[model samples]
Target: MTDLTPPAKRPANPRFSSGPCAKIPGFSLDHLADAPLGRSHRAAIGKAKLKEAIDLTREILGVPADYRIGIVPASDTGAVEMAMWSLLGARPVEMLAWESFGEGWVTDVVKQLKLDAKVQVAPYGQIVDFTTVDFDRDVVFTWNGTTSGCRLPTGDAIPASRAGLTICDATSAAFAMDLPWDKLDVTTFSWQKVLGGEGAHGMLILSPRAVERLETYTPAWPLPKIFRLTSKGKLIEGIFVGETINTPSMLAVEDYLVALKWAKSVGGLQGLVNRATANAKVVWEFCAANPWIANLAETADIASTTSVCLKFTDPRITDGETFAKAVAKRLEKAGVAFDVGAYRDAPPGLRIWCGSTVETSDVQALMPWIAHAFDAEIASLAAAA
Candidate 1:
């Protein structure tokens, strides 16, 4: 029997949006008081802040010493476009897409770049078989599909001795999952996803091979100043350090630094991963116990721990899209959740962010509200019938 009573308890923090996700627990605007407002990003203090962000990121993610990490303009999308424009024409390209973002990359490579790239895509809840992928060609893929709630379990499928570069979009996966730096020649992420920091800035990490590609090959098309990573066939060392191509939000940079500090206080990479894993487990367990709701991912191993997607599985759901939206709406109106709706391009469902910044207790509180919302929606459906 479905319980229509609203859950007595509600999540303390109702932010479950996948991007611009919830801030670190106990976050405060006052934390950004030290931000160098009205100062040039090229100023000494600003550069020091930027360098600290890079160093802390490397320390937390365990990126190799030889790999160059840069703070770039725009977010993860810009980082990806920069890499594609700067490095892809050097070799045969293979684009693997499982979700909307990945598909966007494929479109750019084929339609925009006019590259005769090999494209492989899987449905929303499933991932492409890595065994079928030819790593000999430069490979592009997202480590985790934020929209589809699917992720690559490990880098075991990629060969370490591959001739081509592996460019990975790890926006939602970085700081929350284990990334194999050796297998990835280029990796991109933004501070807004897992870290719950301000957006408009992207982090670009490059292996030695990626730098070599930048120095050795020039693309067929004209490179935008923002996208260019090399000058006179030499890699731009300044970008890899603290110098950015454009002015950045010093306030945003400070917020990221604070988030990074909080991350270290908890336990660094392992701690963040554990927090996200625990938060996702709450939802996974709820789905396991409820027949009406189920994880969108086809398999548990590939299921995302960050953007945990879910769908209604009840037989009574005639209009899946409408029903899902109604449920999400009820939860929002009840003040139990907000921005829990699925991505615009994804199938109708809820996308609850279970990133490191989210507390497990809040996720537990959310589960009962979800049940209440589902039951109320079902009752409304029956009444209409």
Candidate 2:
């Protein structure tokens, strides 16, 4: 092992948990004073702010004018549930998963809904074959596997003339990747991801075809009031504009507005993607030089730029879980990083957030700390042996 001493340069800010990520560069509660607190979300002022969040999301993300984007309850999960409950039974379903979040959706469809669905799965650090997927059937998949660090490159696998809808969980992908609007019938993401805003509210974007499905077909199962998207055989246009299905957190709404404004100030989506790309490159080069670590995703082309997961390659370590946890503990005790450990269901490894909210300089500063922690762990193991 190299020097076990800690690195002198620490990340200026070490808030790198995947979700509820770092806030915009200079985020402050001062920016949220005019949040219209203690006011009804249905009130004109509160509605205006909510509408502003949706509008800014459309402009910043370049969502098509015809697509309907709404702020819904329960973050990304709620949004996905709304889509699945409202739309799945109308057609034969095909669900694809490579990580925890994606698999969770598949469970909901097959187990809960009991729908006629075909489930395709890939282990952690890998992705299912999109080419083998039949676009003629409705498909649900995660655009970015946050826990696995694998992502769908483009919408090319989806045929343009397909008869089905593509529902994608893009929680970690939004604001950092280009989503093919034309290819997706429904897309869901939370503000707490790449944009680093508040949680419990999701931005659900629906294509024209998805709207038609909602208006034309109804599911055989019962849908709770929260999951209902259409009313009286028509899409609820008010929800698309500013009126939410239920009470919303105005404080969270205002914070998301600040994030969207920051995104615009930083040259919009492209700039966000570039910053994430640069951050991922740091880990890429670091892994190249360090033989002990390798990216969890084997396919370089499909590797994620947002949640960059890495696995230990050093053969000396017999207990992967214990070794990885020890290294993560060292980093946390040193206050150099926190919550960088792999997800509970994922393979034991490190999962780093490299979204736009994360700075390249901070990631750069974090590199040495990680190496130092690794060496210290290895040496401790050797001494114990």
Tens-digit lDDT track of model 1 for 23-108:
99999999999999999999999999999999999999999999999999999999999999999988899999999999999999
Candidate 2 weakest ten by summed lDDT = 1-10
- Scanning candidate 1 in windows of ten residues, the lowest lDDT window is 1-10
Q: Please write out the lDDT profile of model 2 over residues 164-282, one tens digit for every residue.
A: 99999999999999999999999999989999998899989999999999999989898899888899999999999989999999999999999999999889999999999999999
The count of residue-pair clashes in candidate 1 stands at 0
Q: For model 1, what is the alpha-carbon lDDT of residue 247?
A: 93
C-alpha-based local distance difference test score of model 1: 0.95
